[model samples]
Target: MNLTWRSSSILPRTSRFYQKSFRVVSTESRKESAQQEQEVTHDQQRDPVLSEEKKARAPFLKNLFLGRFDKDVLGFPELNKARQKNFNAAIAPALKSLMDAVDPRRTDAEGTVPDSVLKELKNQRILGGTVSEDYGGLGLNAMEQCLVAEFTGSDASVAGIVNASNNMVIQVLFPNSISAVNKYGSAEIKQKYLPRLASGQLTAAWCLTEETGGSDTTMLNARAAKTLDGKFFDVTGKKIWVINAEKADLFLVFVRIQDKDELHNPCDITSAILVEKSEAVALSPCPSAGLRGAGIQNITFNKAHVPVEHLLGDTLDGNEIAFETLANFRCASAAQVAATMRGLLTKTIRHCIDRMAFGQTVADFDMVREHLGKLAVWTYAVESMAYLTAGMTDSGEYPDTQMECAATKVFSSEKMWSCLSECLVLLGSKSCSPKEGYEQYLRDSYCHHHHGGANDILRLYIGLKGLEYAGKEMQALVKVMRHPYDNPSIYMKKNFRGLWESIRFNKDNIKLKMHLYGHIHPTLKHISLQPEAEILERLVLRFPVVIEHVLIEHGAYIPQRQMLLRRMADCIIYLHALTAVLARASRSYCIGLRHANVE
Candidate 1:
């Protein structure tokens, strides 16, 4: 009998007698083939010409990487007045009641959020803030969702529950699936699911993470085999650390299609299926150090039958849906982190003011003040970026914000962990005690660093993705350089443009044209003249040049240099934060918000 590698039928087969001897060879060959196939698929996905033509608007940070500052992004975003009023009048009271009912210490000790609190959450429509009003939801926009997330995020467990439903499930379901009728869920599926989800009559879990495929969604081991009738799929696999698993009435599952033709490219083999809770679905609680009340569990699908219409998108569209969903989710998580940091800062400040130190309250000490100052600054920066990104999402101008969202998540999560650690130190032994709840906050913050995507991995993604775009832009320049004689006039034109830019810089013309000084409020004019602002301007001007040089130097092998990529990511993140801070401060000053000058 002929034995073949299951992943690809094109591979050469071997007799049963030689299977053991050729096992290593077959495995290695399969991996190499898979890698080659994946690269080609990714290259197609990253086609610059295609992307540029399809793009309706360029994202702020990505444009910065290309050395063009989008002046429009300089305007700070504000919540819609009508939405703000609605939130205050309706959602605020409900949120307050939910908060009042929740006891973090009790929730942690019992390893479960009380059912009463969950009911309160549903009654408040907190679980369905982002769902459409037509579907029995609040129909909050991106900025509004962020505001609500901030309130829930003060308790990490609650944030996890709400986000899992709103960000992952609702986001993926309606936007990607229903909105694109030709591509994803049928009308019947939408009618069946949306209203129930919005009413909180059903809860959903996003089940993309497998034990083997933690951060790498493409490596998912789950398989969905179409039954002979072709009307249903038998999904079989186990997903670990699935949030809302214990309570989810519906699950959005990602699995590889067990079809011979689709198996050739692993990247394109994944599909998403909606599986309603059934006897075929088994759940086992997976306890964690934090987010104990989040109802995280290991879920096994033992031949769970899902109707063909329940498929979220077209076959092999799982990766796209998953990524788009995650990008939005990560952007929103920054808001959660900002809220968590703000809460920690508030608690720390109150404690320092009341607790005595050497001669007076701890707040009187220079060291304590320094820590507080750092925490406050970071909190401000994170909050600024969070809302700015939310505004970008809400405007619907930029079709892609994957890189920007990743950068925000990385920055916010890290800063949250750092800020909480500082708070812990400020509170000393008291922080370690469960009574203070600082330790709980610290544990929850630590989890954010790895929640959506690990910080280190995301850093590489941010750097490499930027580099990919820069590299594409540099291709023409490289061709000119490689054979200057072949394209003398084109080369000379390029040279002259470079020379003109340099000359313009020396004459301060570039600075005059590119400066954001004109955009800020008159009262904040001095801020534009500050050294930090000057440094930011210099970095913005210098970054693209540095990026070009790095690409020229490293070429295709740059992804392997993790340290360099990390540094690149750090620089981009800092620039983004500085830009956000300036925009926010300028808006505050212009609006004459109280104490705006202090910002």
Candidate 2:
């Protein structure tokens, strides 16, 4: 008998020997072919990428402004660009020189910023940088002021001086007393004060927190009563923890104007101005654990005379202004924290790569890698959110930005502290010495964490906003549900159409499976199998199920139909990733295809 084993048709033979030999050959070839097909199929599955071509690419500016660019936005890119250019070209260079001149690398016995360095910082006009040029100052934007904070934060002393200077500039720029600007001068206030501030010629500090009063401005009791001349207020109070007071040319003191009962609002507070070097004043500097070079002070106003013109805003408006300024300044402080964290991480990563442990670099350790990965993820999330919020505020899309701002501030500042602490751990105690740059970061970060509104307070603010949004969401949801029957016909038609589309979309589901398989086959030859592809396939298969669950769970917060569709989209993308990774891995193994540098 004769047998043809390789034919497409099933072979049958009359002779037992031929039949047996044919069966053995056919079985072996079939197994080999199946294995080859599996290789091909897996490679195809992982071959396709998330196709960068389909990504929505646009400038962050356009994304931010959307359609109402010309009419609605208040922030000027031109203005910011100009200010940034000025900072980079003139201000940053000068400040860098000043920092270098002060020897940023030098640390005293206790990490104190040297007195000479502090003197130079005070002399540099750090206070005048944010005031507009017309206001007897350099007229920098809020963004530039933030950059100065970041620059100074590289060294604690400079950061302290810059903090004092920037806050003072903020106080002068936003006051309701532009008319009083020309009057309070020694011609010197404009000349010596303005030019000095503009040129980093003079620095200043703010005194707001009392021994008893913390975040509550209304609780302040420092008294400012009108003087005999009726043009001045005699301010008498002890203001504590005033930064840069040692060399500050001015002090912004918050005082109570309680006698004017009508001025008592929720935020009713008043500014009692005082000068540091004035003949009648007594300033006692405090020794603080962090910001040792910052020169915190206890100032006794002692009936010190502050010109009535120096009083900022309406007496009742002080609380409002204080809250606003603090909110605005919180963004800057958050930025500084982010920068310091970034720097610390950068330095630590470099150290890890270079330092040997267990006969290999620390970076090679799996545990260390995990920590670095977490640090990286945190940094990315915080940095992106903070920059986005800052851009929003600058562009004036921030009418209700308080919630977002507070959220970003609290999250990023707190994240930065955690990241820094981790970094210090990675560096080890010996490497974390003041001389080594680790301990100072830990110390300075404490101040950064507390500089803005406390995390706890911002959390409360966030909770309030969340509840308000949740209420609105629930009302809209209720309205939709109650009126569901009113549009029965329309709803029927829409549902019918959606069902038709879903049916049509899923009709070629096997083709989806085939296409996915094909895409992954080529990819499998080049790399090791990643679980991402498997997870994606499973997610896609479970897409409809996920939609149902989400509808049941989150229908109140998200519109039912839209949420279903979004889940479906997410599933498709995830499936796409799965197919791509599987294909790539198969292709890598089979044909030695080039593996991507995926990280």
Candidate 3:
């Protein structure tokens, strides 16, 4: 008799696991939209990041990670009465009905979201949440949209659909439709696809990877040939790892465009073309260990013809649009991961409380409590980071959101992986069943590291971006030193400010105290936590020294030094997470939620 690892853990089903660990859970809504959005989304306020000139400048992470302690965004956000009502009316019921109805096991076995569920989700207006109502969509803002993704992350099949839908809603349809058409596409292209995408008449798949390239866009082998008429392009190539490949009506294919006149190694430019699935666009289901309900797939395009109007942007701008889309998609994916951890922690805590072991509840055990504590801390941190990133983008508060999103993605994705393992252990024998959610959770969580951008590539991106910012400052100092005699003012101004900062920077660090309102009630705006918050605050404020140390040593070539950069990037990721947890803890404290303490 062959026994698998999972089978070995199925301890006769008569143990404590049978009654407590297998319980399923259900999943919330809108703002009195504006008030709920008060923390970061003040429409009347202008964000400096919205300005292209200021956006070109890099932000000093010093506020959060040393030099100064910025308290403006350090606390959890408040959800007002209006926002609570808004959430209840628009989002809560729909998600509850959906989560309770779908069984991940069935979806996994079938490898597709059932048509009825998709239709219901469409009716709920979830797919169009990020699109503007003017464009015939629900037009929920980024934070709200990410909030839904968080809830959807609880179940495996639901998580996949939510993840896929989020990329399309936030990246493809919302931004690409507007940016590509208004900023880069011809008017003819804008009119052709934007409305259709907004209204959900045609769903889209973002296909960038191919046999020759995954992260290296330069190596992509797919090519497009322009016909003499200039009205259409004949495309030919294969693309892999396309989300929603089998279901989407339109394919956003990233390809190399070169004139048919050039024959040998002639691809010179990267571009995007929308292809319709047919015999020319052959899709095969690349079902994976997880996200099976999403129909994760690959496609082979055999000389598919795409309209000239379907081209996304100017050839030069295609890569730009793709990278921007990737950044936004990554942020959304991280938010979902946070939600997944939230759900896992919730159910595991419930299981521990209910399951009796050695004549006492599992929660009575010290090890069990410790695991739950870690999960809670991680969940809060990730939730804070994910939503804060969303708020920054939606509110236009952070111009350099790319690195923040990437860091959040890496941190949350990896943390969520650990979270799955912890939840499985706490669930005991119940987790060993194939039908139990943990098996699916483990499989699905693997994609977090690979999707949007692989953790490795994103880590390099974090290091590279940071180095660019560091270069500007270092160059300024160098310029002052080189011209000390020529411009005494330059030398004095640079050195004196530096000297002043050094004088103020004491070795005994104290948090810059400020009142923050993260909860709906303003009277108790300064809710405080214990030693954990203080530790996290200190760590966040000190970690910039680590970044500074590594940058001083490695400089611009940090991108090539992958291993060292990864360590630096991880440090950034964890520091950012700590800040997030601190902020989230404030919210939890104010709202009177359990485990608000990051113990």
Candidate 4:
């Protein structure tokens, strides 16, 4: 093999370029060119690190893989009584009046809410739902913002627009950036945008998703390089499909900000720059099938000059911000789905009582009752998942619930899809008509499947996450097989850990005949769906065994089997969502909040 070496100074780092081993053939022509250079093909490249956070599941989530669906192992995130005041005084009331004044059809057609209504929304502090009071925000926690998010649920576009601007930027992203800057950036950077962001004066959009690589933040075309003076960065690149783009005053653009001063560097270094939408930034609205009110657009930054103060956190903090925001976005998406499903329930019940069929009210029909019951269960489950997640975050039990959040989003969205379908079928042609709000709900509901990470992609996360711990164990076993004589202690756990755990678990299982009875929260003990719900619990318990077996059988090749992973993802979502419903029901029963109960 011929080798050539170049100085690190002159050599440029290329993206995803791998050197292939040369092959030799017996033919004279092949043998002659055996030492020929391998041409580098500029094919479609992928950044393995993009969305890398989704590659592995958190250890807490690994318990689910072990057949411990009882989330109490995760510190069993519950409602904290301390947050009652904030919920009662600000969040709940605001949600009650949220988006109530906006006409869905008119907003859908006109692509904007009434100024009067937006003013009312702002005045009520619904717009500042996620912001802290110090910066003129409502100072609500994740749970509080979730309540407000649920209020926006009736309309997907409303939720997308509001959540994108307020929740995505200020609620989740801004706070993280501020903390990072305070810890890493200068004091001036910390104080720069909080007030502007907290108050409704300035709106920011997340510019992580690009057309070339959708939701792939690693392959960013936009980049920033240090200016010769070392005071500013010359940022350039186009951002597409940014939520609230046209209306945004500030943009949180994700790109790789080059740092030449560092001695040693890690891979996957990206930065978030707070770019104001000035003349340097050109924006054009991107028309969509739904979310018209969101004002998503394609934005171009023609060498936008960003000062050091505008850089978010330290270098390489961009991925953290992106993932944090994405996690928050997933939680908000579930809340939105809950609200949407509830809205459908409200319209359905009202219509059922009013409309007549066979000279009898639709409510009197058995099929209607069945459909409504299913819808009610689904809506309850979604609301449960959303609130439980928000409460989990607020309680600070699981600060990083990447798997749980993604699971909630996928579950809620799929449920919402089924919900709207049933709603449309139940509503008949009236809903099929252009004027009905159901049409709008159906359109907006499509966003759930595609945005906040697509369900197909997210499902792979669930399947893999559930198998993460097991795969690690498998990795240990493989290592031991490769070096059997090296260390008995190292391979001991790999060799017999499962057997011992299974024995211990089986003993515990035998000791406790009824798993659901003891695990059920006291608050939820009163609600008796035990016969059916318990069946689900037991069946779901078996998932870990299946997952363990799959991981053992496939070993490291499991990632390539995304089709199987997606199916496993579907199962895990339903199981996790079911448990979330139980958790939410227990919380509601404890708190006496009837707003989120099934029966």
Candidate 5:
């Protein structure tokens, strides 16, 4: 290698002549070289301290990495921090006031939380976070939405007032479907709908479910056909459980486009646009055990004329749109439910401290303390996992998201319900009665199981996905163990520290797998299936391929020092589960500590 050194004085001459020479040469080549240097400098500026801090935080990061799917793929800290600051300053207070209004605390009467509550959220632009700023929406990131959802769990009904409207619209705005909105929906749709939908001027819903088929998009029975001028469809169908439908200004209805005279074609389901309530034949409210304030209704579209532009995406791609939207919805649902548990824990701790038994506070009892501890631990673990997943999404890591979303929703919902029950028991009779507010929390929290997806279905998904990852890691391990020469002990020792420093890296990946599966299996059944099994097999097969490439790329430079791979791997795996539990457990502790120390 040749090296040249120049002092600041010589640098001036070097720069002066270099600039003249560069001007004489091709400008494009110089621009390309400068751009490459700029990119390197930009990345360095983005995290000058990150490399150092990451080294110190290796053990913690490693803990997060073990035993879960790839979530770091979507982690976006810059966006997350920006949104958090905005919510704390702008949206949080507005939401707090809305919660107070519909709380039943002021009135001591029972009726639906009014549309005005949602209007207040709109007025504050809480419902527009996902919309572009140009459209009068907040345009917040995924983690920001997660934070907003957490704060709302302080009062879910009010959160529903805000989120239900936003979710209905934003759910349709990902990369794939935005084109449909732009092409088919009128310019008027963006002008009229974007601003209000962004500003909460009008709430919305997509009516797709039926009594016979909910998630099974192929089983859709609703039909739409072209009528007069190639721009309209006279549609008729019954849509069950349409959220925010009764009062929403718009409805995106999925109607099956007929294949000749067939009742249904798996690929023929198409969506129609319905903007007029009058055209909507009838909207009847559905009675519900929970989410009472949500305007969930059954809507009948009888000879409803829908505009051609109202058809979203391609006619046949309706099912694809629905599945993708549902996946995102389920992931967000996990974040929302985790917040509910945090809020419930706060309320329960206060009850335990204030409510006495045997001349001591209920929280003072051993069993009560143990229950609270467990709940706090579980809640923390859920939040950590949920936040990690949300961060990944905001960062645009989409591939590994499917499994993480399923796991987060399942773990959070099940843990929250259990936490809610413990708090109910601690509160005694008042928790069960509507007068005390605990019953309502219980009602709303339990309802989450049915909202995005049934708990059983989510469990099946988690079981299969977990097995798939475990299988991949195991196969990778076996390959490395067999080809010991490929990763010589000396090479392993050299890069050992750096590898351990990375939160995702783990050793004794086998022991970590056993520990993870041991806990996961009790919670889920039917883990062995061909789809997941094949995925695992493929992952295992790729282990040597990936290792070979890495070694060839870094050869002598690769680090291989090892200190506590087994311990680090174990910690990494357990910590992911631990953080979720701790969030649940700590909320109660915070509440109890505050109550006992204060009046």
Candidate 6:
């Protein structure tokens, strides 16, 4: 059987270049075709002049891979005073009250959140934090939502409950369902669903992960068949580890569209269907080591009837919808992890200050101080990155932030896990006691490492996404280099510039043309200059050269080289962290905020 797959969903608008179709006859051929299609798709998406304009207007970490850095783009984010104040005045107190009322230990032991707590959350509008006010939600922006996530995430189970509704469902549903905004859903569906969803009258579960397809949607077994009249779809599949499944009134399900002609073959096109609770849907609790109160379950849809109008996006655009939803979810996960780390660090610090060891407080020990310092720095960096990404999302300055969101998720989850381990070490065996709850925190952190997508997979995504941008920029140069005789003037001009630079600078020590010295605040600068600042500048300068070399050597096969991808991801993550830290600290110092120097 021949299989054909086409995706214009990667970009919002499909270019004429992507209209061409290809056929795949075998697995190997499919892989090669997909890669070729992806490269061409990327090339079409990034026109040279437009790419430069986008880089300047919406500079992100990917730009660093191509040796572009705009300090102003990395400037510290500022919150809207009105929104912050509104959140503080209305939301903060409710959150405190809810937190005081709910016991995470009890919730974990029972494997469920109490109805009273759920009701309280509904009343406080926490469940609909990101939904628009017209939909009976709090109308909070991305940063504000992160702030709320931070508060709820101090407790793992609570974070799970809240995020399942706010981060995963509402975030995905609202934009796709609102016709006035995205034109993906009918007005009837929006009016019928959004209000109930926002008011918490109806809860939602995102059902995308199947037993066969844990993270890779291509392996999904779920199938949806359109009825003869095309008024409704019959969906049949089982989704694993579905949060809020036990009580969800609505399900945002992903399934392949089974064509009549391809009855024996696996479907290639995926679609999202809004499935209302019905007798055909079955649910069973899925036991887990952590986040027990999140109401996770395995849901089997046996010919579930879904209206055609309930489709979230285009018929063959489930991949893009899923990717975009996961990206948003990852940004929220970063905030949750950051908050969890902050709470853990606070507890560990208090314990260290009070506990005695070797005739002195644990806090006084050099090793303990080192652990605490590292925790402090990691916490700060995670928080900085979380809000920075959140601000970018809210500001709408950046057109594509999937890479940034992935980096934030990877950095926060891994750092939080490490920090939790350190906290356990600092607190000793007592920390593992059930009553203390530190062990639970560690377990939840472990879950987070694999949640959304595994850190390793996200690392590869970051590397490949950045590499794609870099490769597009180098395509023209590579073409010229390959056939220099055909483009002699351009080749000679490029070589002459390179030769001039080589001749001007010593072979061993080349001067960097770009530096952050002028961009950073005066307080961070000194007569001799800070070593860290200088190191960042050097790394920034050297990064693009390294990317070019790797692209030249590996070419299109870089995706298969996991180790190299991991290393590239690490560098990007480090650079992003350093940039965020410096920008935030500089802003803090300039504003004369308390303990700015300490930060």
TM-score of 4: 0.79
Q: For residues 178-228, what per-residue lDDT tens digits would candidate 1 score against the true structure?
A: 121133566788778888888789889999888888777778899998899
Candidate order by lDDT, highest to lowest? 1, 6, 4, 3, 5, 2
Clashing pairs in 6: none
Q: Which stretches of candidate 4 lie over 4 Å from their true place?
A: 1-59, 69-82, 91-95, 171-186, 259-268, 478-516, 521-529, 532-541, 587-598
Report, for every candidate in turn, its global Cα lDDT versus the true structure: 0.74, 0.52, 0.63, 0.64, 0.53, 0.73
How high is the lDDT of residue 60 in model 5? Answer: 24
- Over 1-599, each residue of candidate 4 has an lDDT whose tens digit, in order, gives 00011001111111010101001123565545434323322110111111112222233455667665533421223322334444665556655665666667787888866666655666665665565554566655555566667777665666777778765666433353111112333456535666666666676788877778676677887888778898887878888778878667888788886564366654546888778877889988788777877777899998888887777777767777776677777887787788778777888899899998899999999999999999988887887677666645543334457777888898888898899888877888888777666767877888778888888888887787767756665566555644647977765665587676567555424333335544544434455644445655565566665676576567678899998898888776776676666544443443344442454
Model 5, range 1-599, lDDT digits (tens) per residue? Answer: 00011001111111222222112224558577456546554323222211121211111222232323322221112232223445666776776676655563322133355657666777777766666565777655555566667666665555554455554455564222111122334456566666767776667776777998765666777778779688887778888877777667777777788542255534464554544566556898777666666667898888887776666666655755554455555555666777777767777788788987789988899998888887776676676676655544444323245545555666677777888877777777776676677666666777777766665555444433333333444445444544668967745663474355343433323222322222111212133222232332233333333333334443333333122222323333343454333222222222233331111
Give Cα distance to truth, residue 280, candidate 6, Å. 0.8
Q: Model 2: runs farther than 4 Å from truth?
A: 1-82, 100-125, 168-196, 199-201, 259-280, 397-401, 431-437, 465-599
Worst 10 residues of 1 by lDDT: 1-10
Can you give the TM-score per candidate against the true fold?
Answer: 0.85, 0.61, 0.78, 0.79, 0.65, 0.85
Q: What would the C-alpha RMSD of candidate 3 be, to one decimal place?
A: 11.1
Show where candidate 6 strays beyond 4 Å: 1-56, 176-183, 259-267, 480-510, 527-530
Q: Pick the winner on TM-score between candidates 3 and 6.
A: 6
TM-score of candidate 1 against the unseen true structure:
0.85
Model 3, residue 569: displacement in angstroms?
A: 1.0
Between candidates 1 and 3, which one is better according to TM-score? 1
The sequence of per-residue lDDT tens digits that candidate 2 reaches over residues 39-100 is 54331221111111122222222111111111111111111322344566766776777665
